[model samples]
Structure formats: structure tokens, C-alpha cells
Target: MRSDVQQQIISIIAREAVLEPEDVQPSMTLDELGLDSLGLVEMIFAIEEAFDISVPFNANEPAQSEFDISSVGAIIGAVERLICGQRPEIVA
Candidate 1:
């Protein structure tokens, strides 16, 4: 069962990907969802608005960013951490 936050995130990602929410899986990556750079940015914006939290994401250098965008599950975990006032580990 998905938590409210998970469901909301899935919906946001689904909207950005033009897919049904059910089709968005936790294991799926943004690339697998066919999200280009612009789509990724938009999704991030949606996430920020939904959670009312600032996401430490650098669209230009996502790989080096502290927030993980490696997969849907990772994104959810990052958001959860932020919501709890915890910063994600700094990626070196």
C-alpha cells in the first residue's frame, strides 16, 4: 500500500509523464518514464509545490546533487527526509 505522500508523488510524476498513476512504479527511473530535461524540471517544481519543501536538486549536475533522482523510490526517500527536516547525505 502506498502512503499519501507516495501516491501524491506518483500522481505528479504520472502527470508529467502523461501516464496513469498506476503505471508509475517506484523502481522506474525518470529516463524510463520518458522525462526529458524540461519534464524533469517541471516534475521537480511540482514536487516542491506538493510538499511545500525545497528540494536540493541541480538540474545541470543531477549526478552530483545531494538529492537522489536515480529512481522513484529514491526520490520518495529524499522527499521524506526533507519533510522530516533531515538533509540527504552529500554525494561526493
Candidate 2:
């Protein structure tokens, strides 16, 4: 379920950043979650590892023009899309 994904993401972020679970929020920005670029990369890796899917990284395109993976919900949505083999909606 969606809650499972949320929990998984929270766990990954907490583990990586050494933060408490209560600190992470569904609407919180990655920066608010205390995740820098390296932390974001680790989060992506954790999501991929947990879901057994590879998240496509289009470095040539702007992030906003790709998937807006700026929050927990967006990250979970992206993972779901990848697992379903569908393209995520690119948010500008």
C-alpha cells in the first residue's frame, strides 16, 4: 500500500540522515528533510533497492522538467511509476 512506501522512504531517509521518523513528512521538501545532493542520491538508491526497480536518471534534462522528486510523496510516486513501468508525469 501507499503507507508501506511512505514508511520505507521514511526509514531510508532516517537511516541515512540519522534523523527521527517524526521529522520526515509527506509534503516536506528534500532540503527540509536534511538531505543534500548526496543524501538524495542515497535515497534514490534506497528506493531502487527496496523496490527492485531502476529509476531512470535523465541528467540532460532539468529536474523540474522530469519527475519532481522534491518530496516524499513525489519520490514514492516516482518509484511506483518505475515499478509499474510507466513514465511519471513531468512536473514543471
Candidate 3:
């Protein structure tokens, strides 16, 4: 995994979610971080802006499932896949 990318994502989430760095675990879900739907949307947009990439949003396909975005690690993985132009797997 890309440690720098992971760290950048963790920093963004921690700052935006108002959570401690240690609290941002790899397996912790976004809901667990207290981010609602709007927060999630904002987070995604922030990520896109930060990385200068577009995250494909397909209404029919549901690019990312709720379960897939549960943790800092998962979120980083998703971003990496997006930057690489690959769809993320919905893995919990």
C-alpha cells in the first residue's frame, strides 16, 4: 500500500471528522467516525480535489457500497484505485 497516500487520506479524514489520529483506524467505518451522508459526499469531493482526480459515480452501479467505505485503509484503497482509473472492489 502507498503509505504517503494513506497518510494524506488519514490526515484529511481526521481533520474533517474531528477525530484523533490514533482513532483513525484502518478498519473503522466512516459512520463510526460520525460522518453522515452529506459529510461523506463532502469527503469524497475533498478527496477528488486534493488528488486532482475524478471518482466515477454511476447511479446504476453504485461505485462504492456503504460497507466498502468503512475505514481509513479502505478509503485510501478506493482513492488509489480511482487515481489509477480502476474501479474499487466492494470489500469489507
Candidate closest to the true structure, highest lDDT: 1
Local accuracy of candidate 2 as per-residue lDDT tens digits, 1-92: 34655677678877777788777777877777777777777877787787776777643452744556767778767666676674233211
Ordered by TM-score, highest first, the candidates read: 1, 2, 3
Write candidate 3's Cα lDDT for 1-92 as tens digits. 43666777887888678887667888887778998666777777788787877766532344455324757777787787776664233221
For model 1, residues 1-92, the per-residue Cα lDDT tens digits are 99777889899999999999999999999999999999999999999988778999999999999999999999988888887774333211
Error of 1 at 18 (Å): 0.6
Residue 15 of model 3 has an lDDT of: 69
| Candidate 1 residue pairs in backbone clash | none
Q: Compare candidates 2 and 3 on TM-score and give the better one.
A: 2
* Sort by lDDT, top down from the best: 1, 3, 2
Judged by whole-model lDDT over C-alpha atoms, candidate 2 comes out at 0.68
In TM-score terms, which candidate is top? 1
As for lDDT, the candidate ahead, 2 or 3, is 3
* CA lDDT of every candidate: 0.88, 0.68, 0.70
Model 2 TM-score, 2 decimals: 0.73
In angstroms, give how far residue 85 of model 1 lies from its true place: 0.8
Please list the residue runs of candidate 1 whose C-alpha ends up more than 4 Å from where it truly belongs after superposition: 86-92
Candidate 3: which stretches are off by over 4 Å? 58-67, 86-92
**Poorest 10 consecutive residues by lDDT, candidate 3:** 83-92
